[model samples]
Target: MSAIVLLVLGLAAMAAGYLVYSKFIAEKIYRLDPDFKTPAHEYEDGIDFVPTNRFILWGHHFTSVAGAAPIVGPAIAVIWGWLPAFLWVVLGTIFFAGVHDSGAIWASVRNKAKSVGSLTGDVVGKRARSIFMIVIFLVLLMVNAVFAVVIAGLMMKFSSAVVPVWGAILVALVIGQLIYRRILSLPVVSVLGVIALYALIWVGPSVPIQMPTEVMPGLSGNAAWILLLFGYAAIASLLPVWMLLQPRDYINGLQLFIGLIVLYGAVVLLNPTLVAPAFNTDVPPGTPSLLPLLFVTIACGAISGFHGLVSSGTTSKQLNRETDARFVGYFGAVGEGMLALAAILAATAGFASVADWQAMYTAFGSGGVTAFVQGGAYIIHNGLGMPEATAATLLTVMAALFAGTTMDTGLRLQRYIFQEWGEIYNLPWMKKGAPATLLAVGSCLLLAFGAGGADGSGGMIIWPLFGTTNQLLAGLTLLVITVMLVRLRRPMWYTLAPLCFLLVMTIGALLLQLRTFYEQGNIFLLLMDIVVLIAAILVAMECAAALKRSRAEVAAEPE
Candidate 1:
């Protein structure tokens, strides 16, 4: 099969999803009302609740959620064959992610921009909020820790990426100050910012910043980079929305757009043959089965619980109008699916032949990451006639930027969770945002530096669990949204069906991983997996009880 055929097919499917299915959802289900006032206006605080342009907010939302997961997951899962990964990315985006993301934003907007964590009380009853918050906090801990390590690893392995990543941050700070405080127009800032970004990309290889023990005096290599990155995250998390997070993500969104255009254009011009098989009945030794693992492995590109967090936690608070939720939320999911499509295409067709592809994906450790980077190099080299090494370095820098955006956002959300918990537990000091911020950053540090793999790869120790936790969270988010819909007297089979399927598949994957951990005598992972399972079961039980009560109330009402 030709790569162009697959690319066209995947893009067409996504267009249909957006035009037909998402439109049906918007008109029939959500029924977004333009007359409805959004929380951005009701609150109207310049700090976090300021009304934002829908296009800008979409950039912020898409870039933050896209991260490395969409790229990494599909790259890894293509080992099973491109067919399974393709189907999941296409159908899953429409049915699962679209429903969850848009519904989450809608629920949050109607509830005055409360996060999904806090809104659980209204939908599932007040008792469920505490448990839901705890689950959310733990899930975020994993996100922060893993992302920090991932960023550090990239810096250590690809020194050239360090300059562009940090350079982008510097650019964001200057742009944020000039535009937000000095009243510069977005068009001027955007053009200037993009120009500066390409300059950084060009300068990265020439003057790469290398991490050393001398920088921090005791920490070296990955450890040194990890500490510095977390420190940056701490500062970034404390700044107001306009200062860092929003501007940096906007820049990242541009970078992603450029990368996508280059890759897709290459596919059209080069028309590479699919080097990877469409179906792999000949399973490799020690590889995971295609059943539940593939679903969990490709969680983000398909659907992620984390998307609901961004939708409800931050984006919902800044929406200018209620009707824009479909554009921001549903379209954001489709955008991510496009990124995943790029990943699948790169992994399947970027190589010259089957043997070359197999060599890059022989095992499931770091091979997938290498393949994605190298495959991307191949595509760029062919498409634009750039040197492969330079293209690979450019892609690495882009990937690191994606991880940085996700990390700070996760940290900020974690701070919010901590503050919420402080109030629930009657701790007055934790109510102050500073203390919660410190605590959140501190926990991420401990996990990233202390409990990680022996070479300062703490994220690796917990990496295997990330997929299961992510999918489980997605399932939980969908379930809560279903309950919210029932309360609104809306039809919910669309939400309910996906929720049921994800729960069953995710639970099976968790158990399979649990057994793997036990067999390997990895007690720490075993315990973590057990705790996640318990949390899932408890949350599911609460949803069931709430639904039962809802049914009884409907039955008793005069019809």
Candidate 2:
């Protein structure tokens, strides 16, 4: 297939999902209320609970959830074939992610804007809440570890990206102050922000920041990069939303769109050919089976549990209207699906022929990003006449910035989980910000540096598990939403089917991973996988019981 055909089909499918499917969900299932006073308005704090415009909130929510997963996951999953990845991304985004995200927003908005973690207690059972929180904590740890390694690897590979990526952060700090404190209009600030980031992009290639081994004695490359990245995450997570998190996300969001536009425009002009096979069961030695593995591998591009965290944990708190959840939640999911599609196209069409494509798949580690980045650069060079070096630098900056956004958001979410765990367990000290932040950051540090594979590639070792755990969390979140719908006496089949499907698939994936990890004798990952499987099963049972009771109640109601 020509790249244009694939691109057009993917774009058309997403647009249709947003227009028809999402509308049905908004009106029939979620029944988003226009008049409902959102938590942002009710709380009205300028810190975390400030009321945000729909567009700005969408940007924040989209960038937080998009990250490297959508790009990296699809790039890797295409190892099986583009057909499986493509089908999963399109279908999963509509049926699974859109529903999960929208339900999270509705659940939180109705329950004082608590996160999925807290809602597990209120909507399901208290014990289920604890289990759910633990699942979240583990998932965020994996997110932090994987994304830290991702950014570090990108920086080392494309040294030119460091300046633009960091420069964007500094620009965001200024933009945040202008918009949040001075009450500048979003359009005005956004236009200026985009312009500033583009300038940084232009200047980045000339001023690369290389971290040599001698810079930190024993630490170099990924190690030094990991430490510095986490330090930034720790600080960023603790700051108020308006200061760095929100504005930085907003800028990254724009950069994401710009990158997409450039990529798609290149596709139109050059019309690259898709060299990857449409369907291939013959993966390399040690590759997992296609069934459950494919589902988990492409989680974020299609359906991710992490989206529930961003929806309920942060976005719900800032939503100006309940109705906007449809736009921010559902559309946010569709946007991610598009990003995944672009990754698929880049990876599949990156090579000049079938042999070259197969060669690329052999090194799927950091090569995942390289596949997309190099392919993207090829398109830009061929179509737009931009220098290959500049195109690569620009794309790398966007990818690193996306990862950076997700890392800090993950840390912030982890902090919230830690604080909740502390309060629920009667540890007053944990409820305080400092201890909780420290605990969250410290756990990430231990996992990223200590257990991380050589040079902290530990994140790579557990990525398969991370994907499965993420879907498991999504299943748990849907279970919580199903119970919430029951309490509201509303139709829940929309949520129930996806819940069952995800839980079963994730469990299967987990089992498959357990055998692999056991054989490899990776004790830490094996133990982590075991704990996640047990917790997920327990949560599923509670949700099943609650769902059964809800059905029973419905059957017994007066006719």
> lDDT per residue, candidate 1, 1-559, as tens digits?
9999989989999989988998888888888888899999999877778788787788788888888889899999988889999999999998889888988898899999988988887778776776677668777888788877778888888888888998899999888887777578888888898899989988888888777635555556777777778788888888888888888988888888888888899889888998888887665677877889998899787999999888998899889888888889999999899999998998888999899888887775434556778898898899889899888987887778888898888888888888877777889999887899999988887777688643456767877988888877787778788886776677979898998888778788888989989989999999999988887777678768887887677668776
10 residues in a row with least lDDT, candidate 1 = 211-220
* Structure candidate 1, residue pairs in collision: 452-458
RMSD of each: 1.7, 1.8
What local lDDT does model 1 show for residue 15?
Answer: 89
Candidate 2 lDDT by residue in tens digits, 140-195: 98899889998988888777888888888899999999987776888899999999
**Candidate 2 segments whose C-alpha is farther than 4 A from its true place:** 363-367, 453-457, 553-559
**Residue 122, candidate 1: C-alpha displacement in angstroms:** 2.1
Clashes (backbone N, CA, C under 3 Å), per candidate, total 1, 2
For each candidate in the order shown, give its overall lDDT on alpha carbons. Answer: 0.84, 0.86
Pairs of colliding residues, candidate 2: 452-458, 453-458
